[model samples]
Target: MKKSVALMVGLRYTGAKKSNHFISFIALVSMIGIALGTIVLITVMSVMNGFQSELQERILGMVPHVVVGERGEGVHDWPEVEKQIVQHKDVIAAAPFIDTQAMFKARGNTRYGLVQGVLPEKEKKVSIISDYFIAGSLDNLKPKEFGIILGIGVARSLGVSMGDKVTLLIADGGTVSPAGFAPRQKRFTVVGIFEVRSEADSMITMIHMQDAAAFTRKGQLVSALRVTTNNVLDAQWTAYELRNQLDDKFYVSDWNYTHGTLFKAIKMEKTMMGVLLTLIVAVAAFNIITTLVMVVNDKQSDIAILRTLGASPATIMKIFIVQGSLNGFIGTILGVIGGVALAINLPQVVAFVEQLFGVNVIPGDVYFIGFLPSELHWDDVILITSVALSLTVLATLYPAWKASRTNPAEALRYE
Candidate 1:
């Protein structure tokens, strides 16, 4: 019966028309603020999650998850090394590669890039490079043909296209003659172009492994063995285990060696952004304190009357707690509904806005992706709602306590 009375009184106070219009307006503002904060938090988190996912797919997909190489010039028995690498359960495939830095020149233009020598058949098993071809085919890189594949950015900078010739000047493999050192140079036909829409597009080129061995004079030796793992996140651990099993002369590396900093930076940025956005919800929750304080002041006589009529201090506190909690509950629900709807269709909404404004929000050249992506996780919504509600409940405590302390004589005296 006590609980029922508190619930009845709380519902009446919350729904009753207020004499002070300003208090009602302030309460409305608090509710709206909470809703707006939640919406922004959820949407931003979803976009950040999407960006992480896309980067993992586009960038990590193009690079080796794990690489096993010799500490010296090159791995002499790469075929045996590949066999040993694939025996690990986590490893899906392994391929031989020769990596070197070179300057590519064509049409009087030169661009510095990392050149990778790969077997077309084995490379396809370890890397997603085959999926990103803009023109030509990987099979065109026939052994002894000296065919090359250029990143789209490299081709554009060199002003070359398929069937055009490009010269690669390798400084490391230069021959020292009686007069001076001469750089090793080779001419290759541009047989393919690929675009991953990342720095790789401007920095990486590919050719046949046989040709690379001949040019580098490493003859039958490979610089490294590229490895694919069943799980990209576990590649580092897998690499460590494989290294322990390999010869002491071999060194092992994983994607983290090259891109871990980028991922860690992204994660830190997401955490900081989440903390800042959460403050908005916290501010909105604090507004509940102001709203409840005004309500307690306005209803002093009512509180005193209830005290006189045998209501306990705890009952009065319960009434105010219920009222304030309702505001938070309603706002949280509305915000979740609005945020989820917006997040799920963010791509379409972004496209529409871009079209309407005649502006490109995400430029393909500037960003790895050309579109805004959103991936809403239900856990994020639940977490935001819980935090908002907790703040709201805490904000009600002081005002409710004050109302509970109302003296019947003093409050009725004013009435």
Candidate 2:
């Protein structure tokens, strides 16, 4: 019965039509603040998660999880190395590649880029580059014919298309002539073009392994054996394990060596954003402290009456705790509903706003991804709600204790 009385009185104190309109208004403001803070935190975190996920998918899909080769030397026994690498449980596919830097000259424009020689069918096993073909076909890049596949941006920059010939100049391989060492030059037909829509699109070109070996004078040896894993996130660790499995003289490298810093930076930014937003929730929850203090001051007479009627101090504490907790609960629930709905459809929201404003927020030429992405997590919502409620519950303790210590005689002296 005492518990029921405490709950009823506590609920009454939180009613909308309370005697003190100003105190009621303050309580409402506290709830709004909490809801706003939680909404922003959840939405922002979801967007960050989406960006990280998209980047991993796009970048890792194109780059191999691990690349194995002899340190500063081409892999002469790549077939044996590939056989060993694929034996690992995590390795999905392995392919040999020859990489070299060269300049492609076409239509009077010259652009320097990395030229990779790959066996089309074998390369398909380890890379998604073939999946992004915008023009021409990978099979057209035949061995002896010296056909080449250029990136979309590269093709656009060179103003060349299928059947057009481009001159490839390799400074490392040359024929000794009377006019000194002239760079090895070869004409290749542009057979295909692919678009990843990133910096790679402007800088990567592909040709058959036979032609690449001939151009670079590397014979049958490959620069590296690229390995793809089932899980992209495990690339770095898997590369380390592969190094140990192979001979000590062999070198192993992963995407981490080239792009790990960007990945780490994204994660750090997400964490810092989460922490900063949590402070906003904390600030909102702290408002409950001020609200409860004012409520206690307004209801001094009521507290004293309850005490005189034999109500225990613990009951008084429970009363205010319930009241403050109710406020926090409402705010947390509201925030979760709003935050989840917003986060789930954030991309659509962005598109709509962009269309309405006649502006482009994410341009394909400038950004890796052309649009905003969002992925709401239930775990984040639960954590934010729990933290806000805890702060609100704790905020009630001091004011509740002060209310419990009220003197009935002193409170009623004026009456």
Candidate 3:
């Protein structure tokens, strides 16, 4: 009988009755549902995280971590102050900047633009501004000289190219220039062009720092200091430290503070998506519960036979537990394989699909990068795996307990 029991429960397949094939099929559905749901959830989350990582590294790379400036007073002692600020342990680099609103006129076209003044040599280290120089180099900027770099969009709109001079109309400090308090006008040579793939790309122009000071007739003072830090997340604290170390007249601001609304929106969106997708996995887990419960109901006679043969309740629980967990194990293994494969190969897959369809699904300017970016973080994958496994364990509890409580004589008599 022991040999028979081993053969029935261990070696050979032991099921409740001949009429319970539908129960087995239902279990298969439960397993497949789990696999599909887990696959979709992990794949979608990974892609979202990858997209966020690309935005931080690329778009934020173009902008500095922090900017120190005041509303009206601007910045004073900018060069000496920048030198002192860089002495901090967290400070990486600092560059003086002249940011002002101006109107650019070229070939009967007028566009409002943001005019920024930068030092030719120092600007490259802090920002990826040099990388965007598709047409000309920052070496073209001359000290105390008027040369300008046009963005790709700005140049296209104005119908101008390198070496074409354009007029920059700036508001001089409410001074009367023989014509009762009018705006000041200056001409700049368009020596370079850059493309940042943002709104600024359409309306930004860069000139030499000294030339900008001279053109605006402002003294050696600048409008701001673009400061780079070793860690961007610490920028807000560093900004506060800068404010306290310096005078109250000066203000310090970080990227998070400057683009607070946008970053907040991204965080909120990612969180909402996570919650929504997790619901699908939960529904799949419910299917697992139903499958296990039905298996318990169908196997009552086999369970009674086992109990009559001195099988312990814990052993009885283990039997159904094994059955339910077998389902979970297979689903999790397949889901992980499928999810990781999709995450790793998403970019190539997208390219292939686009080529096959003969369409440019990802536009360079709109999305910041030329293609869909993906970076599969191992830590995120581990967390997802751990959570999924825990949910699977929870999915087996009630059904296993129900199987353990069957009455041997009553179940056999009914059978």
Candidate 4:
């Protein structure tokens, strides 16, 4: 009976007529504040999640998940080693590759990049590089043809195109002539151009393995064995396992060893962004406190009347708690609905915004990804809603307590 009465009176106070327009406006502001804060927090966090995920796909997709190589003489028996590595269920595919750092000059422009010698058919098993081909076929890199595939950015920088000859000069390459031992140089026909929309696109070029072996003077010996696994997230552990399976003469490397720092930095930035944006919700929660305080002041007479009519202080407190909590609850529901709807379609929203503003939000050359991404995680939604609701409930306590302490005689005297 008491609970029902408290609820009835509390709701009546919340829905007070337009005569108390100031109180109504304040309540409306509090709700709007909470709603807006939740929406922004959810939307921003989703975008950050999207960035981290997309970076993983773009960066990791082109790089080896794990590499196996001989510590001393390189992987001379890479074919046998690849067979042994694949016996482990975690490894899905393995490919032989030779990697070297070199400078390429073509059409009067020069660029320094990594030159990788790969078998076209086997390379497809371990990498998604083939999927990114803009021109020419991987099969065109026939053995002894000395044909090369260049990144789009690298080709553009060097002003070269399909069928154009590029000169590759390596640090270790050169025929020793008595007076001048010059850099070993080889001419390669540009057979393909690939674009991954990343830094890799500017600094990676590929050629046939036999051509690389001849250029490096390591015939039949590959620099490394690249392997892809069933689970990329578990690549480091799988690499360690592969190392254990191999003799001490061989060493194992993974993508984490190569690009872990970059991914870690991205994750740290996302966390920091989440913490900073959460403060917006905190500020909105403060407005809830203000709203409840004003409501307490306006309802003092009502509260006193209820107290005189046999209502306990606890009931008064519960009344105001329910009232304030309801406001927050309503805002939270609306915010979640709005936030989820917006986050799921964030890419389209970004596109629309870019069009409206006449700007390119994510240019392919400037950013690793050419589109804005949003990945709404259920965990983030739950956490944000919980925090918002908790803040709103906590904000009500002090004002509710003050309302509960109203002296009926003094309140009635003023009335």
Candidate closest to the true structure, highest lDDT: 1
Model 3: how far is 98 from its true place, Å? 0.8
Superior by lDDT: candidate 1 or candidate 2: 1
TM values, all candidates: 0.91, 0.88, 0.83, 0.91
Per-residue lDDT tens digits for candidate 3, residues 1-415, read 4434433452223233436777667767766776777777777777677667766765677677988876575677777778768977888899988878898999999888889889977788788768878888899999866889998878988899999989988886546766577777788899999876654567678999898888777777788889888887788888888878876777788998656566677678878877776667667766768877887787789889989889877777776666666677777778878888988898899999999999877665465555676667777667666766677778878887898899998899966
Q: How would you encode candidate 2's per-residue C-alpha lDDT over 1-415 as one tens digit per residue?
A: 8899889989988874788888888899999998999899999999998888877876777777899998766888888988999999999999999999998899999998999999998888887788889888788878899999998878988999989999999987777898888888999999999987556777789999999998898998899998999888888889989989999889999999988898899899999999999999888888888999998888889898999999998899889988988998899889888999999989899999999999989875577666787877788878888888898888789988988888889988886
Clashing pairs in 2: none
Candidate 2 residues lying further than 4 Å off, grouped into runs, are 104-112, 152-170, 174-190, 195-199, 363-370
Instruction: Report every candidate's CA lDDT.
Output: 0.91, 0.88, 0.77, 0.88
How high is the lDDT of residue 222 in model 3? 89
Q: How far off is residue 261 in model 1, in Å?
A: 2.0
Instruction: Report the C-alpha displacement of residue 180, candidate 3, in angstroms.
Output: 12
Ranking by TM-score: 4, 1, 2, 3
- Model 3 TM-score, 2 decimals: 0.83
Candidate 4's TM-score reads 0.91
Give one digit per residue, the lDDT tens place, for model 4 in 358-413: 99888766777777889999999999999999988998899889988999998889
Q: Rank the candidates by lDDT, best first.
A: 1, 4, 2, 3
Q: Report the Cα lDDT for residue 410, model 4.
A: 88
